[model samples]
Target: MKAWQATPPFGFDALRLIDLPRPTPGPRQVLIKVQAAALNYRDLEMATGTYQGQPQQAFTLLSDGAGQVVEVGAAVTRFSPGERVIGCFWQGWEAGRLSDSAALPLGGPLDGMLSEYVLLDERGVVPCPAHLSMEEAATLPCAALTAWQALVVEGQLKAGDWVLLQGTGGVSLFAFQFALLHGARVIVSSSQDDRLKRLAKLGATGLINYRSTAIWHEQVMAITDGYGVDHVLEVGGPRSFTQSLQSLHPSGQVNVIGYLGGHQGEINPLLILQRNARVRGISVGPRQSFESMNHAIEASGLRPMIDSMHDWLKLPGALAHLQSGRHFGKVVLRITAD
Candidate 1:
């Protein structure tokens, strides 16, 4: 089997494609003939030695992948040989709160799906939605599930509620779609006006160009008629956290998902106190929630937005593109199944 691995002094130059013998899965595992994969900001971090998941040894570089179940091990029953599946980000986390960091996520601590073939525990994969292509299904493992967990599973977003989204990254766009899917109004902010305009065409009720509007939360308030948004998908860590808090309604929830902006900034406890906010950190999500989200995607015919695609062998270039911060949505890698 062909695989991609990044070694020490990690970066694009350190990445290499290597060949390894594929093996049979154990009784509780399944073998996947990976067809497509997707890149995330976390994958870029893993390539650059910055992922907080765990210290990297030599490992595969992406967590998001979708493939066909070519062979199931002796005890496997949930999936069959022809079924389409997407690998879970956290292998052992099936549902609920994560009390320990023992189940280290993929793309860093564990060998991920950036191989021609990969093995996963039977419980660590979800069935792909029938309507989505392999490239689209590959995107659901991390970003889409994080958005679903934030807005639907935990936040309990409802119709007429307002959601404040950050830039047009994978998670933010999925949040935008999910917010509208639940009948909620979306107010998204980005430094790029073109992406904001695109989101407006896709049903975003409000758009703010944060680059022009220095204080964007004030714009959020104005858009919502001073009521503030009911939810904020807080991606910009410390630098944008203050405004995200300010953009929320008094009882609004903030799902802390990423630290896209510079990580260093002072956070006032009063932001939480004064707003009576529920600030929660989202760790992608569990396989059970992933399954529920797939059902919704199937029902609504929600296709994932893709910014660009590259051949799987062009992973270095793909990672560079992600690092450049030029993409508007998920970047896909089409794996040629030989």
Candidate 2:
């Protein structure tokens, strides 16, 4: 088998696709023939030496992948050969609140799925929605699940509520789709006018190009009839946190999943108190939530938006593309020929 590993002195140039021995699964594990994987902004961070807590050892480098089970262990009853599945981001978190201690997340602290074949405990994977392909399924484990956790699970989003999205990244796009799924209205912001137009076509209720209007939160309030959005997918970290609070509908939830805006800026607690804000930092999600979201996806027939697809072997260039901030949706890697 072959795996992409980021050895010490980590950077894109340090990535090496190396050969490794394939191992049989343990008694409760399953072996999957990985078909596709998706690159997150975090993956780009890992490549550019910008991500925090960089791994010290070489490990398979992706937290999101989808494939078919080719073999199973003696006691692995949850899955069997030929069943399509996606790995969970938090392998040990099945449901409920997270404890102080949990299993290492994939791609950094643990071996990820950017390999020809990967082994996982039966509990660490979920069935791919029947309506999605391997590439689409690969985009879900992190970005999609994170949006579901923040919007539906935590915010308790309902019809007619308003949502504020930060950008055209995978998570924002998924949140857009899910908000539409629940009959909610969405207001999205971006620096690119062309991308905002594209989002408009995808049913964005209000659009703001932050480049033109720095005070975008006022637009959010104005769009919602001087009230504000019910939820804000705060992807801008500290730089946008203050505005996210301002754009809330008194007691609105702000799900902070920021990484793009480099973590430095002043956030006043007075804004939180004024808005009665409910801010929660999202950590992707657990396996049970993944399963529930899969059911909704399968039933709603919601397809993930892919900005581009690359061959798995061409990961360096793919990561570079993602780093360039040009992609409007998920950038997927086809690991094997379909």
Candidate 3:
């Protein structure tokens, strides 16, 4: 088997493709022939040794992957050979609230699916939505599930409600699709006017080029008739938190999911207090949530927007593409034949 590992002195340059003995499943585990994997901002953070907490000395490098189950342990009953499945971001988190064990994430502390074959506990995988290809399914475990947790499970989004998406990255784009799927209107902001136009074509109710309008929240307020949006997918972390709060309606919720813009900034508590805001920090999601989102995706026939696909050997190039910030949606690495 072939895998990409983050070697010592963590950075993209340290990523190495190496051969290893194929892993075998133990009790209640499954061995999947990984077909595709997707990139996330966290992947970059981990590669660069910037992810919070002690970075792993060595580990595989991707949390989102999809493939076919090629073998299952004797006790494994949840899956069978040939079933298309996506690995969960948090291997130990099955249904409810998280625990210490849930902190053992893929692509960091544990070996991930950036390999030809990967082993997982039966509980850590979910059947892929029938409507999506392996590349599309690979986008769900992290980015799409984070969006689902923010907009659906945590935000409690509903028809006619308004949503504010910070950018056109995987999570934000998934939020846009899920918001529209629920019949809600979306306001999307990006630095590029052309990208905003593309989002407009995808049913975004309002678009703001943050590069042109520094105070994009003002435009969001104007679009909502001064009422503000009902939910904000706050992916920009400290750099955009104040503006996100400013763009929310009274009692609106802000689901903090990423730190693409920067990690440090000052925020006034008064801003949150004034709106009686509900601020929730979102992890990707648990396995149960993934299953629920998969069902919704299947029912709605919602296909993930894939910005580009790279062959597995082009992992470095794919990582560079993700770092370039030019991709409008998920950037995938096709690992093997589906």
Candidate 4:
């Protein structure tokens, strides 16, 4: 077996691949033959020692993966060998809270699925949608799940509502697809006009090239006939928070999911009062939400936007590409031979 491991402390250069013994399942545990894993921006933070709630050095390097069960423990009942599956980002939750016990999560505090095989409790694995390939299903556990939680759960977005998507990153792209699937008109913003055009072709109702029009909120207002958007998938850090508030109609909802732009900044407190908008910070989501979202995804036959796939031996190169921010969707690593 092979695994990607991070050396003591953390740094991008420190990530390396090495051979390890294959894992065996215990009671209620299943051993999976990992096929594909996707890279989140948080994976970069975990590599660089900057992520909040980062695990100790002994942990694995990725939190999202999908595979097929090759072995199951004696007491396992929900699953069996030969089932296709994906691991939940949060291992402790079967269907509830994001964090229940101090369990080691894959690729964080626990050994992740960056290897040929992995052992996880049955509760941590979900049946992968049969329609999706292993690579596409691998993109779901984190980025896609977060978008689903924000727009559907917390935002209470409904059919015919207007949604504001921040950029072309993993979460935003998933949000775009999910919003459109729910019958919402989506407005996507990107610094690149080309990307915005691509998003427009993908069913986005309106596109805002933020680099050209710095005040994207005004464009959002215009697109909605001055009513403003009903919900926002807030990916911007503090820099875009104020504009997100201004972009929403009174009593709208903003789900703050990421801060890739930069964290240190401030928002005008009066906007919340004046707009009567509700703002909530999201932490990806709980495992139960993941299950519900998976049901919707499977039924709708939604396919994840995969930017690229890398070989296991070139794992560092994959991380470097994500750091460059040159891709439009999820970057994945092929971990299994089959």
Candidate 5:
């Protein structure tokens, strides 16, 4: 098996491709021949040694992947050889509330799926939606599931509700799609007008060019007719948290999912108290949530919007693309031919 590993003192230049013996599955485990993988901002953090609890040794590079099952352990019954499956971001989190054991996520403390072959507990994988291709399914584990958890599971989004998405990244775009799937209207903000135009075509009822409108929450309030949005996907962390709180209607929720902007800033607790707002931090999600999301994707025929695809060996280039922040949607790595 071949995999990309980040050498100690992590950076893009530290990534190396090496050969190793293919891993065998243990009881209740499954072996996957990876067909595709996707990159996330966290991958960049891991590569640069900036992620919290950085690994002490080398590990595989990406958390999101889709592959075909080539073998299953004797005790495994949920999946079989030839089944298409996607690895969950938090392999140990099957359902219920998160625990200390569930904190070890893929692509960091644990070896991930950026290889030709990988092994996982049957509980760590979910069947991919029938309507999506391997590349699209590969995008679901992290970005898509985060959006699902933030909007559907946490926000309890409903028809005609207003959702404010911070930008047109993978998570935001997926949130936009899921909001529409639930018959909700979305307001998406981006620095680029072209991206905002594209978002509008994808069911964004309102758009804001944050580059021009520094205090974009005012735009959000105006779009909502002064009532404010029902939910805010707060991906910008400290840089946008204050406005995210201000843009909400009474009792609205803000699901903190990312820190794309700088992580340092001040937030006022008075805003939360005044609006009676609920601010929740979202990890990607449990496998159970991934399964429910798959059902929704299949039922609605929803497909992920892929920004671009690169060959498996082009992992470095893909990472660079993600780091550049110009991509409109998920940046994928085609690990194997379909």
Candidate 6:
């Protein structure tokens, strides 16, 4: 099988096509014939050796992927061969709260799904939503699931509530769509005016051009008639942390899901106390959340936004496209059985 491995110095430039031994399913695992893989910030971080999940020596590249099952282990009955599925991004965190000590995570500590075929614990693979394409489903496990968990699960977002999303990135866009589907008013902020216009067509009730009007928090306040937004799907790092904090209602919820806007800075502790607000640091999510997200996505007939799809031979180019910050949604790489 052909697989990709990340090497330092050149980052993802180390993607060399090479043959590797095909993996067999374990007692509770399933082997999948990978059809498509999706890019995330974590992949870029891993490529540059900056991710917390980076390997010590050898590591598998890429994480989120979707495909059809080729084989299943003896103990696995939930999924049968030939069923289309996607490997969970957080392999150990199956449901509810995360367990501190767990193993065999995909794309990080364990081998991931960035190849022709990959093995996963049966618990780590979920059926793709019936309405989504394999390429669309590949983007769900990490980015989309994380947004779903934060905006829907943790925040308890309700209709008519004002939901704020920063940037036009994958997670933010998913949140924007989910919030819209739930009948919440969406406010999307981006530095690019063109991107803001595009987001408007996607059901955002308001747009904040962060580049032209630096005080986007003020705009959020203005849009909500001074009540502030009810929930904030915060993807900005420290740079916009204070802004996100200030843009919320008195008892608002903010789910910190990414660190794209500079990682370190000082934040006033009084903000939370003064406003009675809650802040939750969000990782991707558990398998149960993935299942719920799939249900909602399938029911609503929502399709994921695809920025571009690259041939498996050009996976490096897709990673570079994600790193450039010019993309509006998930970048996909098409893989095939060889």
Q: Per-prediction count of colliding residue pairs?
A: 0, 0, 0, 0, 0, 0
User: Candidate 3, 114: how far from true, in Å?
Assistant: 0.4
Model 1, poorest ten-residue lDDT window? 95-104
TM-score of 3: 0.97
Report the candidate with higher lDDT, 3 versus 5.
Answer: 5
Q: Global CA lDDT of candidate 1, please?
A: 0.90
All models: lDDT?
Answer: 0.90, 0.90, 0.90, 0.87, 0.91, 0.86
Candidate 3: residue 217 lDDT (0-100): 88
TM-score of model 2 relative to the true fold?
A: 0.98
- Find the 10 residues in a row with the least total lDDT in model 3: 95-104
TM-scores of all candidate predictions against the true structure? 0.98, 0.98, 0.97, 0.96, 0.98, 0.96
- lDDT of predicted model 2: 0.90
In candidate 4 the C-alpha lDDT for residue 44 amounts to 88
- lDDT per residue for candidate 6 within 64-151, as digits (tens), equals 9999999999999899998999999888787777756263557766777888989888888899998788999999988898889998
Clashes of 4: 0
Per-residue accuracy of model 3 over 18-129 as CA lDDT, tens digit each: 8889988998999999999999988887777778863658888899899999999999989999999999999899877775454578998888889999999999999999
Q: Write the per-residue lDDT of candidate 2 for residues 111-170, one digit (tens) a residue.
A: 888999989999999999998999999999999999999999888999999999998888
Cα lDDT tens digits for candidate 5, 1-338: 78989889779889899998988899999999999999998998888889877898999988999999999999999999999999999988988888645456899888998999989999999999998999999999999999999999978889999999998898999999999999998999998999999877777899999889999889998999999999999988898999999999999999999898888999999999999999899999998899999999999999999999999798888888999998988999988632
Number of clashes found in candidate 1: 0
Write candidate 4's Cα lDDT for 1-338 as tens digits. Answer: 87888766679777877777887899999999999999999888888878887766655679899999999999999898889999998887665554555545678777887888889999888999889999999999889988998999877778999999998999999999999989999999998988988888889999998788988889999999999989998888898999999999899999988897798788888999999989988777777788889899889988999999998678888988999999889999888553
| Cα lDDT, model 1, residue 96 | 71
- Clash pairs of candidate 5? none
TM-score of 6: 0.96
Better of 4 and 6 by TM-score: 6
Misplaced by over 4 Å in model 3 are none
